[model samples]
Target chain A: MTQPIIRLEDISKIYGSGNTEVRALLDVNLVVEPGEYCAIMGPSGSGKSTAMNVIGCLDRPTSGRYYLDGVDVAGLSDTELAHVRNRKIGFVFQQFHLLPQLTAMENVMLPMVYAGISYNERRQRAEEALTRVGLANRLSNKPTQLSGGQQQRVAIARAIVNRPVMLLADEPTGALDSQTTQEVMAIFAELNTSGITVVMVTHEPDVARLTRRIVWFRDGQVVHSHLAPSELSQTAVFS
Target chain B: MDMLESVKMAVKTLTANKMRSTLTMLGIIIGNASVITMVGVGQGAQRYASEQFESLGPNVLFIIPGSDDARSNSFDLPRNLTLEDAEAIANQVPSVEAVAAQLQTQQNVTYRNRTANTLVLGTTPEFTTVRSFDVERGRFFTDSDVQRNTRVAALGSELAEKLFGTANPIGEQIRIRNVSFQVIAVMQEKGAFLGNNQDDTVIIPLTTMSNRVTGNTSPYGTEVTVISATARDEASVNAAQFQISNLLRLRHKVTTQDDFVVRTQKDALTIVGNVTGALTLMLAAIAGISLFVGGIGIMNIMLVSVRERTQEIGLRKAIGASRQDILVQFIIEATILAAIGGVVGTAIGIGGVTLIGATTPLKAGVSTTAVILAVGVSGTIGLFFGVFPARQAAKLDPIVALRSA
Candidate 1:
């Protein structure tokens, strides 16, 4: 059996209690198989970002059985969660979260540093990942030296340099122009095509249309799991 | 994550904000520098005092006529000591290398209307050797001169200049109390000691001083004020003292309390050393306060750094940096700042010490222990003060940090 790279079972994340109680996720079940490119789309106050946080291992669900690469990670401690995040999940954020003090090569080698990889191998792999993203000559350039699209490409290279099981992006192209957005999306599509599982969180219908699967959230539940962009207007997604 | 990587990251971060890093390290620099310089100054003072005490003459002992308590209680001490006692000590004490007795008196001397009252010191020929005073011009009085009661005198450098300026003082007739006395020698310049000027005086033979200048006031044979002795070597000082004490006690026929006291240069040196040592300690302690303040400064800067780098910290955590890794990185940054400050401060402190050595009478030496201690203490202060900010950074929630950023 080929185990799914991500499996979320009966997940519930509630904030506060009594009158202040806010249910971010309720009885959610999500399974992302290997090599799948998926997008989680929702309107504001739809708990899509909270779900992304849980799936990225940045926050824990109140009640759930989360299995990443077939291992139950719901009960892991913060340190162990950190280890799982380092070895399994690679995150690309909306702002291109590259450490400003470091160059592109150093930024990409950061995840490998946490993994205790050899320095020379980390440099070699970072070079390969940056070159694959069409940044072969900009290895030593800092984040300010790169354009918005180039910065996102460096973030992508950093995210994939460790060879993680899943490449998780939260609004990966949110800060880029339409042209740079398409450029970043193409890199994600190429990475996903090469057997790297990709899960993106975005509200744009156009961005969601690029993914094979679009999971729509309403309030705290996944209302439409298989919605096509052409039919998104037909359903009351905001309601 | 690892030590090497964390250190590298810390260096990069510090280099990125050069102004902030240097400002954060200023406290440590000032603290260590003051500590080093103050300690050096204290040691220099101690050495200066030690040399001053040592100039009193090595292996020399002074046998005062009366004991300390007796001298303190009575303003007029019993004039029972005599030249016979000094002679007895010189003959009886095997450890005694040389002995000289002094009888001091103030008298007026006239050199062709240039009359001035001056201190007259009557001492034997051995006084030059025992007291370490040298004769510069003519010869000092011999034992035969003392036996013959020669009416001759040696003039101190300042007194010779005062009485016979431009003209040579040798063979000049200087009248003391209207009695003619010929100047035979001019004594070399000996600086002041304990506020008393040694060069503002005249020296004469003991026999001439007792018989001619000052009348014999004591019923005892040839009364003397203080008897000074030199031991054969440094090791023989105590032996000489013990033998002289026994000889004096027996000669004086003392049945109850002793009649004299023996004093050494070592005692005065010890007292001076203790005083200067305490002063040094006080100075060093004051400087150490700056070190404490410096540590607090480090803690303050580190706390600010944690707050300022919240976004970077959050991004690192999201990427995979553990709490321990972030903690190590922040701590390494603080320690590196303090350690660099310590080394720089040491260099400046050594420079300060060199400056003091060149400009002042003090031979200030760089104390190795102080250097080690200052550097070690600064590094420890860095490590100690770094814990709180590092812990705060480590405990920050990645999501909260990211959102806040």
Candidate 2:
């Protein structure tokens, strides 16, 4: 019932040209409504990462219409696209790309810096974001000093620092242990419940099952879309 | 990010790699120090030479015979100066305070058993006054000695000491070219001038030196070699020289080329100034080459820094740093390095110069202008050499950079 925050229509992405051309994506259509939580599942070379990059405004689709909040993304300049990414989308990577030189609090304040917030206000907001991720005491620690799970939490804090409209995570728990992965997933689910749309890419069925809905991608096209089971017993039975 | 935060980050990055940062700054430090010290040395030399030249009175002038062509080429010796010429100048020229004519010859002087090769200077009674010579004992030749052609000579202080030892030579006789002459006075110590030892000569009456010592009867009249004159003050020296030149021209009936050269103390001072100025310029230019090489070193190190910090650059960009912000950060890092190096180098340069001054006769002067120039130039070199690496760091793609690590 809610208007879709992101829309892609008949998207096709081709690499190279002439005889050497290869279709990376063929007539793929997808929509994500505001406040929705979804996971994209696919095998190797299924074009899921490419789709994620395009969706996150890190890359442009070859020949397609990508609308973010009703604005055509293909028509925007590189700088404008970056602005869109800064204002509307937050990205969480598997490797936890936090600046090693900056403290945890300073790293979280990065997006707010780009947003042109005053220094005091940026500090206050960044502290609040870190506190929300249970890192209030670790605010002064650098990325190198934190554990893998703690660093991922810091990254999540940084991603949500500006309170972006959507969070695009690509295998966010790929580098974490099972226990830490569960903790990061719990934080993601909590953020999603607070009305921030979350789109995650994962090859693990277990990780994908944690989301509310799942979209299975095969050979550059979505083959299946369904609601995940509310209980782990039913999800295990379905798998 | 705010400027303060950017600067803080820059400083933090530099301090993180202490050895690399120090090594990078070494080039700039040596460059700045070399520039300051070399220029300071050159300036000091100039000042020392100028002060020495100033010590020689400015009102002195020398008139010597022979045209420039005859002097340069060993053609024929021109005889234009005479004792009469000196008398004429002293009487006619109002600017001329005194005129002394000199005729020189080399002879063997014997005092008892000791014999030595020495210079014999034949000059008028006024020579001592005009040349600023002081008599340590007895007195100089008088007008009566010149008129009577007295075989009397004044022993220079060193020559007297060498020949007579502790004996008083005032009223003693010394043999010059086998002819015995009475030593009327002992001239005081006068140091070296133009490589010639003024204190190693003996002064005698002009007629006695020309007739007895030199044994010359020339076709030219008197055959005086040089006419030394002095003006009342510095302001009158040029006027005295002009009058002497006109007088010589009239006496020699010269129509085109001059047969004599009039040299003044001011001319000697100008020549010394020009030579020292050229030397200072040359030294500065050679030192400037080292400074330029130091700039190249800065550029090389900055390039290496950019390569080493590639991952850091990516992280910063991913964290929302703009291209300009990255550029400014790197530039600030370079500037801090050079500024610190510049201050240290300036202090080292001043210390080096002071040390040299203390150890040698060379007077080294500290120039505030050189200090400012050294610091300013180092800062500029930082800005200049930092641009390329900063641009490279700024132009990196955030996505590709983030993926690099």
Candidate 3:
């Protein structure tokens, strides 16, 4: 059987010390299988963002065995973790995080710069990625020139351009209007249909409902896990 | 990331803020320009000094009758050198090519009521050959003229023009110190050397100058002013100096601190070279301070840039740019600024040099070595000063950077 794309066992992240201490995550165990489309849901200060950071290889767990694509990465060096993030995980932030200086095509080509892809191949791949997001005619437009939904589409294109095992997005539709939110969610669904595993963090119940699974967090620990209607009978609970 | 990409990024960022970048480069430009121009001027001064000494005659030595210290102290030199001594050196010294004894006095010269205070130089016929002065018209006096005390004079090129205007002055009669003297010839133009115009003096026979013009003021056997001698070849300059010193020491009968100082052309060249070289170094050092300040300007602007672009840094780091990549990008940006400034400064400096050359007597020239060194040094300064800011940028934590943005 194929291994889970991400496996976190007994993960804990502690900040500060003594009276000033706060636990961002505590003994949280989670698994995300390949081709799974999931959403992490919680209110403000619920540690969902911290969980997303850990899963995205952008932060280290205080104590845990975290396996990504069958390789334990919790003890990896920052550079090694960055390499994994570059090749295995793609991230999209709520701010869109597109470099203002770069064009849409160049923004999509950024990840491949670190991957040591040749310039010609990068250009070809960036064009294909932009075309895939229906931004083919707007390849040279900077982020400021594109609309909110268009910028989000460009961000999505950048995240999936490297063909990572999973795309992790935090509040991907938070800054968009309802119509644009639907458009971005449709793109996510399309990407998920193409067999790309996607994990998103959001507070909107309606946004979380579109995913196949929802992992709920409160305080600093996982409180509940819900599957889609087809697998709702197998729902799990944690206290 | 590759270096090319880093350079491209640097160019893009610099171009985005063109006004700030150019303002930052101003210091470097002025610094480089001053450095190059000062060096060129210093070199020109050295060359001018050497040319002046060269016109004094090739492989020549001067035996002055006082020590440099005594001269600097403004004490009167004893009138001890005689025409006989010059003749003795010419006849006895094996290394000597020619010797000339000269006496000088400022006297009023008049031609058709055009009275001018002119320097009157008294020397033998050998003075022309020993001093490399060519008589362009008529002829110089002979030994008989010195013996018979003929009041015949040779006009220096400028003096001749002043007294005669467009008229030929070879056979004209000019009055010197109330005595009418026949102008036997006019010497060719020899230009100016060391603020003293060689073409402004009048030459007469030594005996006539001592007996008629200056009134035999010295009681010691027709005492002359300075004795100028030329060695046969370049290699014998030091030997000639040595022989002349020994001869003068023996003849003057000195026991302590011999009454005369013998100096070769090489000695003058060295002194001038050291002085001008030191001045050049001082000028360059002062100019280097500006380059340093320019570097500080770069560092300041770059630090501000890193701060302003914290969000961009975060995005780059998130996309997998290493610390070294950021560092290289910033450093390359600074180098480009400095290099561009250096190139423009070099052009400005060369223009300044050309201007000086056109307006002055000094043959100012642009040294290629100076150009290369200036540009290279400025580039290195950019790299050196760029490090602190670049390191700060490279060491920033991506999470904090993104959060601050």
| Model 2 per-residue lDDT tens digits across residues A1-239 | 65687898888888899999877787889999998889999998898987887788766788889999788988886567667777788888888887777899988888887667888998999899899888999999999999999999999998888878889898999999998988898888889878889999999887888888888888888888888664434443212
* Superposed Cα deviation of residue A226, candidate 1 (Å): 1.9
User: Model 2 off-target regions past 4 Å?
Assistant: A1-3, A9-28, A69-82, A215-239, B62-94, B98-229, B243-266, B353-363
Candidates ranked, most accurate by TM-score first: 3, 1, 2
Write model 3 residue lDDT over B99-211, tens digit each, in one string: 98999989999998898888999999888888889899999999999999999999999998888998998778899998899999999998887777889999999999999
TM-score of chain A, every prediction, order shown? 0.94, 0.95, 0.95
User: Highest TM-score, which number?
Assistant: 3
DockQ of each: 0.61, 0.28, 0.40
Give the lowest summed-lDDT range of ten residues in model 2 chain B: B313-322
Candidate 3 residue spans exceeding 4 A from truth: A204-206, A227-239, B25-37, B51-57, B71-94, B103-122, B141-152, B170-182, B194-196, B204-225, B232-236, B251-253, B342-368
What would the per-residue lDDT of candidate 1 be over residues B1-405, giving only the tens digit for each residue? 668878888899999999988988889999999999999999998987788768867798988877667888998777777888888988889999999989998999889989878989888999999988999999999888888989899999989989998789999899988889999999999976644678888999998898898978588788888888999999998888888888998988888888788878787688788988999899899999998899999999989988988888888888888898888988899999999999998999889988998898776889999999999999999999998999999999998888775
B173: Cα error in model 3, Å: 5.5
Whole-structure CA lDDT of model 1: 0.89
